[model samples]
Target: MAGVILPRFYGCYNCRKRVALHDDIVNKDFVAGYRKRAYLFSHVMNVEAGNKTDRRLLSGVHMVADVHCGDCGVVLGWRYEKVYQEAQKYKESKTVLAKYKIVKLDYW
Candidate 1:
């Protein structure tokens, strides 16, 4: 599936609401020199409620694809993070969006 292009969508895990695909806040790079744009979605574990004592926590963002289904308008899945080395290469190259393909849609 190196050359295959998958569809994308932005789906809310809470209400299962989906919206049209949108631009991602950051760019990602995949294996074999593939690249795509993606956004961050905070997961339940990532969120921390305030406690009695003053304390801060480090939470990671759950990345999701910025896509929306055209027919039904449901978000497919959260975006996955790409390899660090590959992503760095893409960031340095500064290429066009057409250079890479949308490989997966993590629906479910």
Candidate 2:
């Protein structure tokens, strides 16, 4: 027999609903040198403008595994490419995408 550990909840900012965390696709070695780090970068749109909304744009996709709260479905930190690139100019640094907030649904 095999046992699996999974997240219990996922909060969606768009709909403001807390959904179950299923359909997980884990990439163990998404980032190099950062053994525990993973990347989840998907295109998303900014729909806050009502009509004439901007199209989906490229979001940087790099995250550390330690910042996620499986029980509450919150992400403490994340790193995006734009921020990463900027940080790279100075040195190798990871940008803090979000700090202790519900992981936005569109972020995936």
Candidate 3:
């Protein structure tokens, strides 16, 4: 019998809720707060965005919202709501998840 292959996913660290697919990762060299590693995903699931606020980041000022795990309410990262700099406009509407805050799942 042929074994079935499953797609890999990234889950919340607090709870094993599936959040983002490994295939959906857009940028893997992203850096989160405090110089921590992160990844920018094209899409995400099982997460809730908090209130939008303007903050100065390494890039520049951006309007972002903190994203939390829908199940355990843990802060995973932030979603880019708006980008002021024209060169950084590509980040808008994308989600950034801290590498330490997520775990790889479905790997055989």
Candidate 4:
């Protein structure tokens, strides 16, 4: 197993449940709230989404749902359920996990 390599992933900060792989990251220059740093991921696992609600964000009004850790039920970030702006439509169905809410699970 010396030469074998494991995929790097991010886990819930509270429960350490695997949530997303590092390779799945779509954007790293994202902000959660005012100045809180966050990352956008194309996919995630071991997380539950809350009810979708239309909220006005920095970019524009978007339908989003809060995503929580499945094991600990802690709010990590929000997922874009619907993007109203045509320019932001690429964010649809994507999940954003707060940088402060996830921890690296594997060695670099």
Clashes of each: 9, 1, 0, 0
TM-score for each predicted model, relative to the true structure: 0.21, 0.21, 0.92, 0.93
Per-residue alpha-carbon lDDT of model 4 for 1-108, expressed as tens digits? 899868899999998999999989999989988799999999999999999999988898999999999999999999999998999999999999999999998654
Candidate 4 displacement at residue 77 in angstroms: 0.5
Q: List pairs with backbone clashes in candidate 4.
A: none
Off by over 4 Å in 2: 1-29, 32-34, 44-73, 76-81, 84-108
- Residue-level lDDT of model 1, residues 5-33, one tens digit each, is 55454443333333323344243332221
Off by over 4 Å in 3: 1-5
Q: For each candidate, what is the lDDT?
A: 0.30, 0.31, 0.94, 0.94
Whose TM-score is higher: candidate 2's or candidate 4's? Answer: 4
The weakest ten consecutive residues by lDDT in model 1 span 43-52
Clashes of 2: 1
Determine the backbone clash count of candidate 1.
9
Return the number of clashes found in candidate 4: 0
* lDDT winner, 2 or 4: 4
- Rank candidates by lDDT, best first: 4, 3, 2, 1
Pairs with steric clashes in candidate 3: none
- Residue 88's lDDT within candidate 4 is 98
Over 1-108, each residue of candidate 3 has an lDDT whose tens digit, in order, gives 479657799999988899999989999998998989999998999999999999898888999999999999999999999999999998999999999999998652
